[model samples]
Target: MRRSRCLLPAVGLLLITTACQGGSSEPPRATTPGPATGTARMAADSALRWSPAVVWSGDLNSCRQGEAAATRDCLTKAMQAGGASADAVTAAGQLSSAGELAYVTAWHEQDGIGVATVAYPFRANTNEGTRLIDAGGKRIDVDTVQLDDTLRADPGVQALLNAHPQATPFAPARAAGGTPLEGGGVRLVYRTPLRECHACADVGQLQIGYDFDATRHFVGQHVVPTPAP
Candidate 1:
């Protein structure tokens, strides 16, 4: 298993203090039902909505820090430090939060092929930004609006929360990340501490799959047993 270090704030905020692991090279596998998958479908018709504006606002604030020009300068330095060519910043723009942290994303041409990178300020409160290059490093088409945001707002997610009120406390914070599907769409994941097992480190997660068009087509939930400290 791949191990990673993460920092969880009091509000259950998920933050990656170090470099993030690269994505899998293989294509996404088919969805298989797990023991917790049943309860994930408890509510199929509730209206739960996520606000892209809200997400964008948070993302902008993260990098901009109230000064647009300074944020641009930070991004320029970040891309340069990441070995990006001069033209990278030309097509780059601020993307929604990557892994829930503020980042500046830009596209670059490497050996005639297009690639994208997400850069963030270093952890030590420095002016430089560390870059997370995509695993494939393939040309990335920027989507200012992400499908995962829609998945978070899906009624199914709300329905799941209604079925299990305990999960409500972790609302918003429970939302982790979304992975793009092979066919088209994205898989939204949510992880929250188990209510009954307060003393245990076990975590319950709900994974919801949505089509490229933003339709929730699959729902699965499972409890991950705590790992050894």
Candidate 2:
């Protein structure tokens, strides 16, 4: 799924009073989105879906103000910790909006589908500029890359979710916490609904984890169902 400039509403210049998570894919509704250098290039099947977001707990107070390279660098780290995809983090630094923004919203929208907000713009000085970042951010091109299309189409993924007849088509990436994996490997997380729908306030959820060896080759997967509330 691709992020839309329209779906994202304007966020006021407010201090993020609540803390957001340290960039994770759990709680499928908490993914982050940001801006891209170019329009998103996604799989043909990707379509819009419902997404709700929460503020990340990571401290970005230092990032709240400043436009210097160092400040930007600090914000970059904040975004990284905030679960922004690698590309969105990089682009956050690269973005040179003509105007200055006021504050970064604590409640970030899920990017692409209904999971995370990789990149986004706080209602700055005006309504002239707004963009998307990464969360499931999109494709295998997310933090490292968006969820690989091959994986999304993987019969295995569908099979795993087969027990749940109502899983939605939406998929959002979950960023691994800041801690590093033991063997110098990488871990990726993603989630989807147990019931299918274009939009719903809440639905059954599932968590999917992917493990890769240090060489970046696929190792295995772990799927867990989010118990109904």
Candidate 3:
């Protein structure tokens, strides 16, 4: 959710892959520590369930080195902190590449609860910068006003663009061949800057995309719930 510092690079980055369709809610009171269960659990109760928080990923020793075991361990700890049942934790899978990572964790109801998958793929470096393309097809450098104007021009991506303008197209925002994963699902592509984490600095060309149904598989495709204003 926090992406202000997610600016990666400006070129030559591969794309890759989620969990719930949307962000998870805050966990309910930590009274009885057990698995979530029952048909009611299908509702994704944030009242007692923690959202899928992002543990560290994208750094050299953290994830960039293609460390499956370390990556899995990091995500597992994150899910546990978010209150995942032991079984659900066991269902987690780690998918990572040169400039991408997909951390998956399963969830279930309170008592032998049904299971659902949650995945989040972090991408870096892209061919497209925040430049704007006019109706005449002229490209414009990224500036605050110009970027806003371009997004407003497109009805389809207007709203999403407004909401996540930071994720908009940028210079050097291109990708190579994108292959489908196991389920013949939508292909993913991404790009970012040289450095991974944006802890204090900016990550320029960060782009990412995933299959349509991925959100549904992870979080149930619908409007992800948001907190009160």
Segments in model 2 whose C-alpha atoms lie over 4 Å from true places: 1-117, 121-166, 175-183, 201-206, 210-212, 215-229
- Give the per-residue lDDT digits (tens) of candidate 2, residues 108-156: 3321212234333343222222222333332222222222444335443
Q: Write the per-residue lDDT of candidate 3 for residues 60-106, one digit (tens) a residue.
A: 23333454534656655655676655444443432333433344343
Order of the predicted models by lDDT, top scorer first: 2, 3, 1
- Predictions: Cα RMSD each: 20.7, 19.0, 19.8
Q: What is the alpha-carbon lDDT for the whole of candidate 3?
A: 0.33
TM-score result, candidate 1: 0.26
Compared with the true structure, model 2 gives a TM-score of 0.27
- Give the Cα error of residue 46 in candidate 3, in Å: 28
* Cα lDDT of model 1 by residue, 122-223, tens digit: 333222221212223222222121223333354443444454444422222233455665555344433333232334342333322211213333322222
Best by lDDT, which number? 2
lDDT of each: 0.32, 0.36, 0.33
